[model samples]
Target: RRLKKKHFVIECDPLVHEGFESTARHVEIPYLPMLVPPTKWKGYDKGGHLFLPSYVMRTHGVKDQKEAIKSVPRKQLRKVFEALDILGGTKWRVNRRVHDVVETIWSRGGGIAGLVDKGNIPLPEQPETEDPDEIQKWKWSVKKTKKANRELHAERCDTELKLSVARKMREEDGFYYPHNLDFRGRAYPMHPHLSHLGSDLCRGVLEYAEGRPLGKSGLRWLKIHLANKYGGGIEKLSHESKLTFVEDHLPDIFDSAANPVDGNCWWINAEDPFQCLAACMDLSNALESSSPHGAVSHLPIHQDGSCNGLQHYAALGRDYMGAAAVNLVPGEKPADIYSEIAARVLDVVREDSMKDPATDPSVPLAKVLVDEVSLLPAPLCLNQEIFFFMYLFFNKTVEDLDIGSLQVDRKLVKQTVMTSVYGVTFIGARQQIMKRLQEKGHITDDKLLYDVSCYATRVTLDALGQMFQSARAIMAWLGDCAKMIASKNQPVRWTSPVGLPVVQPYKKYKNYMIRTSLQCLALRREGDAIATQRQKAAFPPNFVHSLDSSHMMMTAITCKEAGLHFAGVHDSFWVHACDVDKMNQILREQFVELYSMPILENLLEEFQTLFPTVEFPPCPAQGNFDVREVLTSTYFFN
Candidate 1:
């Protein structure tokens, strides 16, 4: 009663089968998901409009809407949410010409050229060695070479992906990237690549979708923006002086605009080459117009902070000297903190070198020829034979230290000074200096470079401590508070000025194995015990970051209400050239308003209320600097 079924088996030729099997063996299998979709699940009302409360609740992943509303006060949430929406809604388009240039550079692997210039040498061939020590050294070299190559490849892939997406978006009228906040309430574009957050090439290839007439003020600002990108001694000049510098370079700018790759390549030498090139093009277009003031422009002029973290610290402590150093108050020229630190470090080195080695126990001594040679005391153990030869050839004597031979400049000490507020360790500072020294192609000897980096790091930190005494006191107080809370097995928690709750997530974690169909997976479970050291060390920087975010959010909201197109990258703010003045006024106003509140006092009060049993130190006393002075301080945001 059952029907018979027929089966067919098909076989290919033996040669074909062999070829297919070989190809299959060489192909890589992707075990993980290759691509992720953008998050677009925003909350909408019955009329399909964005609902602030609903969106916040969904983003925070709170099932109870009422509870979410209670955590973030409704009024504060609305302001932040609206600001984010405004930021996301601003449309952008790619500069087709610049995009093409970027594509050409990427095709030739130009992205990794800087790494090569920084002493990332080519991979070496494997050596046939029987000695175990030699083999071990060769293995280390191979590993380092592989790492550099992998990094270079990764950078290339990232650039290509960005360019591909940009090419696709260029055909459309315009594209908008949605924005969201981190745990600390810092807003960022949700889309990873091809956003304003990328490098100089990315910024150069992007412009506002909408264009406004470049009136007289806008044109002046455009020229200043160009000069700013060029970045040299001219950067510290006043606005009028900057404009004059641009005027003087009119011929070079035009040449760069007309022939980016072939001409003199004047823009190529700028601090931000691609952006500077874009500015040159914008300037050319404006000038070629019969009515230069009436030319349409879409560039966003930037006003960056001068070491913004230190600025906030200075503001919080009301330290006038610190404020002036960071350019939070008025100055004839914009203060250069890095250069000032470099000068202080140089003075310290010279003073130390001038001490008589025989008389002063602190002074370091080294024997050298008496032919008027300036010698830096070597910190290494030199061979006795070499010392004896030097003494025999020339009388042993100490000479003036040739400070000029040492390359201690603003660039050398910039990173150390910048990260000092973030609690960079001594080892970390030394490593930063070492990399800078290597890039400069001075001190090729590994041991000598290490010694110099160690010395420089010490003086750099000492200089920072001396310069920002109030900042140090505040940092110590913050660390102490975190230590106290973390010692009690609780994470430090606080509410930002904008009412966003921030919790330190650093805690001890335990690993567990989970059995899956394919294999066993190890996952980490966050434990109750706090990571006391990390919690203590990270609090100062994290707290400062949250405060800066609050300042930015306040500025964003105010700028939006004032009907100005606005964008921000942490401390740096941007608006159209025409709206720069208005945006500056609003930013200054919001800054003063944000700091007017008793920030540290409120934080201490919150901690006291949250942990009644834990006794905490009182807030540091405020200094005499006036917050209102920022309003008239032209260089505050420059």
Candidate 2:
């Protein structure tokens, strides 16, 4: 038995066989092979532990920045370091634009290094740093990089804030500075962007500013013109200096002042476009001695510069014309407000909310002004229940109950809503309102903080961090969705519905799909990474937006059929004030035509083809469509 046990427990031995190739006597030879080994994956170091592969970093949002920086060839790396030596380490105020890109990238660590390392682009030459101060400057440069980055973000916020305040002051208090006005005597040197970017859409009656208390409530010091008398973009002034305008007794003068005509000759002002148009009607009425067709209507749509317009790009229709987008939202804040309002006005009774909100009568009254004097049309008033937004769009809480459909929930409506239903222009002001509401200790909830947190997302957080950094768990869940969808394919590339190819950030480095990042699928936490996959989930909405742009572009082309000179910023259009009625008519018609197309179905069909085997979640609320529901709301575009 012992012998048998020993035999069974025998030691394992390797079976090795060696074969020798017969030497060929006279071989027509191939070239001699070099001593290079086979290619292997280049992995990058991340936060400690095992290094992450560049594929994982690119395919996921987790940037292996250290490895990325190291991946740069030594020659290029030295150039970037040299550029930083010139810029005081990280000061954005640079004398030469040549070194800006490289110095900026170097300061931030990695991102653009691959661009230079590949010899795709050479770093612009800047004056060499030879000063004794250069040594100490660069030593602290990397240390101060984080702070400098923060300052850059702060500077962006300041720009937005200044633009907001300038829009308000321009509307509320016209600076007599002659330089501010452009060739047509309109506000010149405006930011390339539009006004009230963070506010809700300015949907209101165009006829009356009579009883409208007409301005943001607490911009206390904007009653006077700029003290310098050199009217330029608000960026020209310091933050402290910009806020010190005289606020007592100036709104009337500002209103009475000549409104500037923009490039399109549209009347730019603080009032909603609808309100301005009505005001133009009154002005035309006053100017015309003769009645046309005896309609008893007169208002000259001439130049006036008091109003501030939005650069909005909302698409609601179906086909080329987007006819089905019965409800349209232009800017971000406006979209949020109108989305809430739509939830209310379109609300319907439900057994566990089974009824479609679109069935309610309040829908028509939702965005339309009750009368000319009203400031807001009818934005949904928040109560303790709906006090906070669930997210930027389509997020909802259980407290957002069915009473909104009843239209009789005035008791549920809070007093924060003013009698005049004007749109919110400054998101900061809007946040202040929310904070004030929270302080009252009535409806305060975590959603308010979450909503506040989302503001950072709007300002553009780090490309990789955006997914994991969502304030709400749902956003993270959505990030997971993005991951799943994006993981199915490598060398992933998709074009917008209108043809703008979705460029990968990896392209920013190598200018090509390196396939280096797709190996992320092999990672242990393959399910968790989403930074790179955000575009996947965003595809549907982004495609719709592209269609919106397409529809608008075609609409601009089509509008020529009616002798109109039209210019649009996405969903919103600007024309001479006199053309307001005509523009609205054409816009409504064009929207109807666009919606008439089967845009949503087409998009879904494309989605199904791309994600054939993979089971995706049910269609999101943003993409769910009902042309019947849309056809009834003329105020949708407004």
Candidate 3:
């Protein structure tokens, strides 16, 4: 009867039938979906072992019963696989107090409200008019409002899902999230709803099941971690300064932990509110203990990279200035790359504003010229009208310009600067800046907001080009190489430092209509022709990403070997407070080791070998800065 019911549902649901058909095409023999009857819930086995289902553990007709290790790529990949195994096996449990707050927020559909007040509800006033222009304007506003609401709804749903999973798993002794790598070899948790790889709320609700005693050093590091979560200038402080900042904020932190929703709600203002609250709670617990230094802690302390992609580029090119700007070399405090970029952009804008209209050829002038004798007393002449218009255009006074009104800060241009390495187009930068402006809710007029965003994007890109000259040249070289290879109708391919094979899968796809019982679905199938433009545009960033992943994997492997638990979110790495210093040393060593190899030269050689007839350009010239300097750089990863 159950089988009959399952079959009935499969037949009746067009989406399910389509999914089954798709699955069947990939496998040699398609089997019916597994059926689990409703029964008393039994979480995990008696010994606290949570085994992955047989279906999830199988690949290529081989079932992994013991370790659930899938097909290993190569020898180097084995180390990465081992690292992933170590990461996945790390146990975690819910912080019930934080979980309760998150659940409450989720129930209210206000998960995103903490990040952006009233962001979910965008209600534009409807115009009561029959005029076509007004109606069109109203329609556009409605469309934008709907888009905002949809995004909010999606976020709400995501919060609901995460909270539900956390609630169910809270009762267990602990649970583990399995890990997998993307095609670029970047590892991510396989569990969708709950893991360390989640937002601030998700992360806050979780704590390592295995606790370590917070010794003096560990306690100090934990204080530093708390300061880091508060962000702003606190994150740029030296270790001791950060600790001091945390100490200064002890009253606020304790209050936040004691009465999170009621008291001062100081944690709500933090960069990561929920996580900050969690850190506050941890700090409060440690301090309240009879032996503060001996208190057990399960919170993971993170040491994040500063503009990591640019850091890699700087290291690759040996650009000392770029390296220093990104905190690659030793420094008292962590570098603020975003603020530096913002300052550069402001300088450019100010310089542009101060340009002489009469001498500068770029400045627009009034086309009409009027004699002083022809000045009319009753009304202005055509020349006067033109001159008046050009006066506003060419000569914007400091007060009229209101450069400060734009509030060109680190936050405004951070996203643009970050993605500039990945070949963000001018239009893309404008959109990114526009989104930031919209979120800030400063410029109410859409037209003026868009103009400001466009202006900001130009200056941001200009600043980046000036600041990271070597990175720009390298990006150009990579793009050129990709174009040369892709013009011959072949996808660009490369090997990462960790020997993970990477192939740019960008290609033209042919769309075909598949008629189903309920609807006609348009499906895309890979075509023989290569997508040359996409291949060229994506290669530089993709190649950089592969290298980034390589560095991460190397660090992960060494951390495991050194008996340290590790969790990585791309450039951001996390470990136990006691093990942070060890993990940092390991990461720095791995980064230096990874870059020490002739990476670009090897890539050129590989390209030559793969396409013998095609002549690739020489690798970008390197600077004089030593890669070993990273070893001594304290803020290289912090």
Evaluate residue 53 in candidate 3 and report its C-alpha lDDT on the 0 to 100 scale: 39
Q: How far in Å is the alpha carbon of 517 misplaced in model 3?
A: 9.8
Q: Write the per-residue lDDT of candidate 2 for residues 103-195, one digit (tens) a residue.
A: 333334322312111111222333378776875666555546645544543433333333333333333211111001111111111122222
**Considering every candidate listed, which one attains the maximal lDDT?**
1
Candidate 3 per-residue lDDT, tens place, 286-305, comes to 99999998999999999899
In TM-score terms, candidate 2 sits at 0.33
Q: What is the C-alpha lDDT of each candidate?
A: 0.72, 0.30, 0.71
Local error of candidate 2 at residue 166 (angstroms): 13
Provide the clashing-pair count of each candidate structure. Answer: 0, 49, 0
How many pairs of residues in model 2 come into backbone collision? 49
212 Cα displacement, candidate 2 (Å): 28
Report the lDDT of model 1 for residue 105.
57
* Candidate 2 local distance difference test against the native: 0.30
The true-structure Cα RMSD of candidate 1 reads 11.3
Task: Between candidates 1 and 2, name the one with more favorable TM-score.
Answer: 1
